[model samples]
Target: MASTNAPIYDELFNVLFVIGTILFIGMTALVIYSLIQFRRKPGEEGDGLPIEDNLPLEIFWTAVPAVVILFVGLYSYDIYDRMGGMQILSNDMHSHHSISSQEKVWGGIGSSKQESNTSRDFPINVELTAMQFAFLFNYPKGEIISGELHVPVGQPITMRMESKDVIHAFWVPEFRLKQDVIPGQPTILNFTPTRTGRYPIICAELCGPYHGGMRSTVVVEEPEEYDAWFKKNSKQTEVEL
Candidate 1:
């Protein structure tokens, strides 16, 4: 089975951190050196010199920030591609639908050529309805469930979320992305969860009194295991009905 690409994301983060560390060190060194060297000396009165224009220095600093901003913009875009483009929901996306305009612009940058494939083999669709505190999941079978979410591993899952009451954020930290569950209208997010484990699906947005308690679990199991679980849940649900 194909595994999750979290390590690659972590490595990218480490790279950015290295750059940040360099910036911090450079700024700190400059500040410390200036404080010690340009401090008001002993027995010295406040005889400050008039400030003059340093056009070259100003341009240098301005250009530095511009370059830094551009680099950060490009680096962030590259990371978005690594998360499997619109596959933010699951792996089987290529089999189900074509690449619509939304996927291209949803996560800041557009996807790569390899990610723009139209057809897929096994697409997973999950409809999420968010309310005051928790999210309700609706599968194609029309059964409503709560608490835990079950999905088959190594497949693309397209999550369509809508707010039942107010705005809510559907976030899975492990997935490294989130989309708001808006009111009245539906919002979509896609991802392919590679690992077969229980991942927390938290409501990152504050809704109401029980906002802090809003939580759910995402269980990623093997294909067979997922099918079995669904069958069992269906039988139990039918018995209740």
Candidate 2:
């Protein structure tokens, strides 16, 4: 299984592919038919038929495309909203709110519509620092620092990311999540890992030399396993520090 929102992205992609295929085939067929049907025969003359436009035909062609566009626009917006796009936008707008405001605004992808309606458990907070050659994962709770990220399966996570030098992107294909990590600009990524396995974390942006070497892994395991690993790593990190 992929992340919770992966299926949503897949659904949208499938819809678009189908729509594009239909339009391509239909338009190609029409072009071929018009070319052959209107081609001059051996004795064909000029101005064979000065046909005027039919109101119903014109209306039909215009209405068909208008309806298709409307449907596509609405469906795309719905998918975006379901994937927490609106929530992210809202958080960004609220980030500029006055300091006196009590509520905190978080950016990047937040909870989906269904997740937002119900009560939610506290997400696992992880700080990600992206540099030229690597990504560092910092667990603030235990003061742990590691090159690879480790998390418990089926648990919500909120990753706060920033860049130490230049702009970078944190992208996990299975999770269908990508966010920019820019210098002096903090960003957030929220998701719930549904599968218990390891996924590669890649820097989708073109950083500097050896950008391909800037890669990591995220291990998602059961709660017990994650707890044990976290404890052991945190202790080791403390000793090294």
- The window of 10 residues in a row where model 1 has the poorest summed lDDT is 107-116
What is the C-alpha local distance difference test score of each model? 0.67, 0.78
**What would the per-residue lDDT of candidate 2 be over residues 1-241, giving only the tens digit for each residue?**
3688788888988998999999999999999999999789988666767787799999999999999899989998888777776673344332322212443434556466324322433466688999998999987766679999998887777777889999999989989888888887777787888899999999999999988888999999997798778778774544211
Window of ten residues with lowest summed lDDT in model 2:
91-100
Could you estimate the TM-score for every candidate?
A: 0.74, 0.77
- Candidate 1, residues 1-241, lDDT tens digits: the string is 1224455567678888988999999999999999999999999997788889899999999999899879977877667666545334332332324334354223311122223233432345567788888888766553546457788776666666778898899878786656688886556666566788888888988889899899988889987798777767663454211
Question: Using alpha carbons, what is the TM-score of model 1?
Answer: 0.74
What would you estimate as the lDDT of candidate 2?
0.78
